[model samples]
Target: MHVRNKSLTPLCGSSRVARLLVPSAACTLALSLSVWSSGAAAQAQGPNPPPLAMGLIVKLKESQTPSVVRLRPSVRPSDAAPSQRARLYAAANRKRVGFLIQKPTAFGAHVIHSGQFSSVDEAEAEAARLRQDPDVAWVLVNRLEQPLAGRVNTVAVPQSGGVYDDHFWLKDRTARPGVARFATAWGRIGANRSVAPVVTAVLDSGVLPNDDFSGRLLPGYDFVSEAQYARDGNGLDSDPTDLGDYLTSGEKQSNSAFSGSSCQVGNSSWHGTMVTSMLAPPAGSGFFGPGILAPLPGAVVLPVRIGGVCGAAISDVIEGMLWAAGIDYQGSPPANPNPARVINFSYGGSGTCRTGSATDTLYRQTVTALESKGALLVAAAGNGDGSVGVVGPIMPANCDGVVAVTALRKDGTKSSYANLIDGSLSAGYLGIAVAAGEFVSGSPGVTENLHLISDTGASTAVARYIRPDVDGTSFATPQVAGAAALALAVNPGLTVPALRQLLRDSATSYTNTYTTYAGSAPLCSSVNRANCRCDTGTCGVGVLDADKLVELALDLATNSPQPDFSAPAVAATSFVPQRGNGSLAGGGGGGGGGGSLEGVSLLGLLAALALGLRQRFKSGRP
Candidate 1:
């Protein structure tokens, strides 16, 4: 596999990279809060309006040709197709709709331009008319999707004095809910040198290979199809390096090209870098600490650039998803050598799963495709404000078979920024939740939201960009993905549904603490949407507990009944429903688990079982 920036050494080992940092300085400086633009906030209210008149992505029934006039990219001599006449529809009350038939996409959809419209409403009306055509299978407006996170308040200052621990969430805690007690889990992962490196794909803004990633990056493809959004001077390409996504003042003007575009004008969010580093930063790269998956022998991250300055188009996102799962679909880019076991979608927008709309059908189909490949899809529940009137988590998160994860504060109550299930049948989506904080203390009354994020648009420069007080479901999503990767590292054969069950089952219950930064909090429901406590039925299964998750995975590998050892394992379609107690559920199928126990004897299985039991009992869950 081709790794980006193969010459760059690991962050801790590279003196050259270290020179880019400032002397160990510390400051409690308060930076201005750069919140999401109103454009993004408007997206939470409904499905993003399709680009004014760029085109609509539509899939046709098998062997059916479009009746609308097909317009090719050019009318040059080399270009074959020209304008063709179509059947007239008086009900549409429009002349012939001219279409530019772009190349077929990886998801079997065709991008076509059906005449430019005056407004989004006009375009949507045209789309509705097209959906009624007999040849069309499904139609998508090709709306844009934004990263489901925002900078609440962050400053890239030096570490505070005294014994500093940047990664406080990983350590075991007795007072409140902590992520994972890495003692036994890390030790076992470190000792297993023969285990194959697990790949977790980050589908976000493009990534650049920095020292923090070191030896854990795989060759990725840029799926952004628009040159303006990509800002890379070209469309899709092999290089997924992030060019600056920052929009200028001129770009946001009413007469500018970005006027109707849903993208907000802001600084380039090195989103992919931040998420990748958090998921698998090198073991000792940052101040004597490791990321959730850094301790494993080989924890590889596949960076698939699907978003850009204007947010990712739905077509691009689906294409990136299919490619990341290593599925061989028509018109896809080169096959991915390293297929991801756990795919992290740290971005989302407004939309429910069962809306019965074309968007809903598209997401459901794509997610189902990923599951068939035995890859688990983990998505953020979105950072929609509580005032939006609970509609459950955002699209894709509410999609079936997906493990939707919401965010919580260090106090184990729902983070005010995260969107959650509101106990309404319309808003109910079964999944998991995790405390989004990196540091939380009771007596000192301090809750620092620290994350390994990029403070600069310059992808190569490391500097001192440990963004403190970063809050969003975006930050919380990757932790779950990394924990899922760690579980897969222990048992590579865990099926997608089974992995979801194990992770949900092993999660720690919410403390149900009503106290929060917003003062006395109430329980969140379909109506109570403010700063509130989370219940299993409302938020998710519970807060993520990596220690218990890995322990249970180990137990399942040793104790589960052996299936046929002849052919590869096929993942089951349905999974065990969410529950509180930690119990292994769902049958396993293909997921690179072939021959995992082919040569091992019964005695070895028994020994492994004993080890898992010992770690579980002695790990001190309380």
Candidate 2:
């Protein structure tokens, strides 16, 4: 799914590679990964059944040069650079294979080598030798780490001023105990890294170059290649502006050959701008707005354009995601000059990461790569109005190693449309939500406050605010993102994994079942359908408490890895969620586990829609 414009919002391996397995016999079958399907199965949505290993480390058993058997002496002590010791070993091995970065430091910081043995025999021999040697601590085959997307976007800065507002999610109480108390957290963070800024990436519809972002918005790239949806008349370009993705009835109907009912016609929502405002609103900039990070120094916003009027292609979104993280793809836009420390993807679809699936394997590799870089990826759990596990397993959100954030209302109850969490505890860590506004259908003026006013990146008009802003988990994700940014800004030493744990640990707990806007039946839940009205993964350990998160961040400023404390590690691929209505939920909200309409996916609705309107090439417009 692509980024939602205020709405809630690939790999190759074989003709279809789906899983990666290490040959248990070692070296006998070096780099073995293969799967196939005859005529039709190959054409479906599933990946071909083969697994590919990208990287592997093998040490020579003899003095074949400092003994490829060079042992780490021990697991390297905590006081010592265990990561460095491992790297030195890797560097030595790499040197024999012409590898670069010979010097290494820190433990668990093994270098990701791109070399794979040429044949089965060679790999097996090396694997056998390494196994027999009493040197190495651990040998892993999942080595090829896809680096950060590309060079990060950087921006120059000036000074500004503003007082924290009561409505600011970071400071004020949204009539809920789960709110982020950033104002309090700032006390510790502010004094430590007085000038350090945490770079944040806003992945969404193009953000216009506006004054609100003054000296903080960096030069981002436009990854949407489809000219029609981009409305720019050109494919992927250097410009990341909101080329205006307005749509009409005809576009959603005939011009696009879509279901008229599933699509909406309207002007672009300037989603990236809205999300950026919340993340790093310009401080002391008048009524334009006060942001979660804006009040602080050293926080930069990187605007990455990944969607258009018709949403974005999954390919483009991934590319943008990688680029923002400083990993360049195909090398076109060059490496990100200013890679962000935190990436906020406020949209998703009803897809899933099935166990033993090739797609899931590849997703894990990428997610792990980013985490290794100390970057935090925060995503919306989804706004499908159903259980996320039941309706989703959405990209990034559902993918392993990502922080999945659900949405909540000002009253600390589950938002009617928020998605519930279902991934396992460790890698499938899920985060609860904070104020993402609520819309009352029957009651008028029940105004839900999730306001973060700022300049419409594309407009010349002054700053403005949304009463009950187009509500969705899309909005809630940023609150977490902002809180995270604050933590990093104040304490730059936190690693992605540690930071994620701190956020999860510090969040306010939702002790009771959450009530939907209209008091819907049966709240949401992870294991039992009888317990929730619209559960978003066990209330996600509670709402995001900015103050508490900061406290945790301060305590963990040393960047130590936290012990895994999560539960329900999303079972390997077997997704069978129990829906409130008594149906065995599927990913994407289908009768079984299909696609989720949870947040902002464009899977065309099938209410027997007299045939109307559509994340694949990742889909939506509002």
Candidate 3:
């Protein structure tokens, strides 16, 4: 029989009565009296309570004390034994057993089974007991739900694999051609092919099979609902499947496009194909040349498809990122037979920074977890032209432990659309910039473009040099991602922070100047590049210098006891700044094709003039 404690109602709630009764009645009464006395004393002491009792003891005379009473044990055969109680308590406290529940149905919770009960009597008894409490929902005992398996393998896109061809020209050669020459020089320095094999996970459109990428693609999972076709009972597709984009606008609404015939076929834009090609093109593919510089020839490519034809949900993308980096999915992790060493995210969204957003939190947690496992994350800086650069650096990239990349034109000048760093902005913003040869000049030849047609038989617009003058930061990200693969190849143990520093320290410095087209020019000369220093404002660690980076990595790998590459100061600001507003005019209108010549014409002239002046100054003949 249970009796409600009337006096305790205003003090301890009904739920806690059972707990209070566990102690003796006299003890409970004493504790209550002590609490009441303390409150009264605090009031008398003018609001502040007196110090707690140090050595006070409650003493009762023998006459005043109640006589000790002994009662018969009330044990029943049906009652649980002490050992059984202990086992139940242990199971209740187990972290994995508890199912996270919510009032309304929201996602992100898992259910676990405590094994089948022998009879409904036991199951009903548990359910009735738990239902009486507010925290616990009905505890139904039934067959457990099957666990969802995550994709672990990835396949490389056929024909779409190779190192960046530095031969492509941009801006009619107004800046220095040193980057290309540097790549060539680095190749000759015994450092050629010194890169270690690195696994790079591509979280984008699905990959299609081709003869060019034989034995290169690893098995991967497609999370997009439409790509359910790529999903096999074992988890991911065994064969490479074509993936298309979902149009965000037009006749097809959100769910409307999937039913059409065109919806079933993949689009020919080949954004993912283009990006992978730049990083790891097949060997002996004359499309680019005899070979491209891929540090990890045997490095596995894990294609976790999060983005769909049109775009992808932030949640889906986050899950893909976490899964690719070997984070558990929905509370369970796969065997992770082939975990990625580096994750390449070439896509982004237009969103502001916020604390609790799913995208932001997931990105932060994912990066921290991945880095702890010795994996590095590389993301595109985005194509938006906002003041802060790429919309808060777009999750994961903007997150603390990940490296963000911005694009550079062939002339070594930051692309106009590329995000810039301004002094007014805070630190920890803007992506590290790298040269992604101009889109127009780097377009594959007409014959090559025609030859590499998609399954749809439509000409890949990305492969064609249709827009002679258009530029975007989107085209520049792959250069940095590919470079990171090389860095990892040289030093497999390099941490995310160390890799970022190494890239910055070994970067090539250039004079930063802001330029404007005929209609976009600002009147203030102070707004020009002369005022903006290279390593100061928007130019993050200047531009990437592959040769210096390879040298640094090799030095670290050989364990020569060199200076600490992990030191923040040495890593962040080692590159020297080039003085003056080094602007090259003429690629768009200055009357010449945008190519390496433009860079030579502008930077070469400055280099020669600087050399001649130094010689004259030394001779004292001026």
Top model number, lDDT: 1
Clashes of each: 4, 82, 30
Task: Give TM per candidate.
Answer: 0.73, 0.58, 0.53
Q: What is the lDDT of residue 589 in candidate 1?
A: 18
Sort order, TM-score high to low: 1, 2, 3
What is each predicted model's overall lDDT from 0 to 1?
0.53, 0.45, 0.36
Q: What are the runs in model 2 whose C-alpha is more than 4 Å off?
A: 1-168, 191-195, 250-265, 355-358, 385-393, 423-428, 441-446, 452-468, 512-523, 526-537, 558-622
**Candidate 3 error regions (>4 Å):** 1-166, 169-182, 185-195, 225-240, 246-268, 290-295, 331-333, 353-358, 385-392, 421-430, 437-471, 512-535, 560-622
Give the Å shift of residue 286 in candidate 3. 2.2
lDDT accuracy of residue 562 in candidate 1: 23
Q: Write the per-residue lDDT of candidate 2 for residues 26-145, one digit (tens) a residue.
A: 000001101110101211222111112222332211111221111111111122234434544664464343332221111112323332212223333344444443444333232111
Higher-ranked by lDDT: 2 or 3:
2
